[model samples]
Target: MKAIITVLGRDKPGIIFHVSEILYKVNANIVDLDQTVLEDKFFSMILVADIDEINCDYNDLKDKMDQLGKKINLQIKVQQEDIFNAMYSV
Candidate 1:
């Protein structure tokens, strides 16, 4: 399975570290990632990860990411690749 992860919020330190930590714990291998800070204050990131061998259920991973986002004051979202594509298809 593949997943799309997005992170957005005021720029801050350790955002990537914390987000990647959760993925690491769940054994989600990151296949691609893009991140940038706009005007040096807003942060945005999109990551594609391979979750076929994750250690926990998909919902569990989502919850973990949510919790981490709350703790870090960022808006983090995880979506199944197929659903994400379907929703955004032209």
Candidate 2:
């Protein structure tokens, strides 16, 4: 399964490293990614990852990412690609 992951927070170091580390631990293959700092302070990132080979279910990964986000003071969201598209589509 492919999923979309988004992160938002104040600009700082190690955000990408930590986010990627979590995905790596779950064996998620990042297929596409884009990130930027807005106004030189707000950081935002969006990525698509393949999670079909992961051992754990989506909820487990979401919980882990949620914890990581809280720990790092960031807002993180994970959603299946189809659901994401449906929610955003006109």
TM-score for each prediction?
Answer: 0.93, 0.92
Tell me the lDDT of candidate 1.
0.94
Candidate 2 wrong stretches, greater than 4 Å: 87-90
Angstrom error of the Cα, residue 48, model 1: value is 0.5
Per-residue CA lDDT of model 2 for 9-83, tens digit only, reads: 898899999989989998999999999999999999999999999878899999999999999999999989998
Q: Pick the candidate with the highest TM-score.
A: 1
Output the number of the lDDT-best candidate. Answer: 1
> How do the residues 44-64 of candidate 1 rate in per-residue lDDT, one tens digit apiece?
999999999999999999999
lDDT, candidates in the order shown: 0.94, 0.93
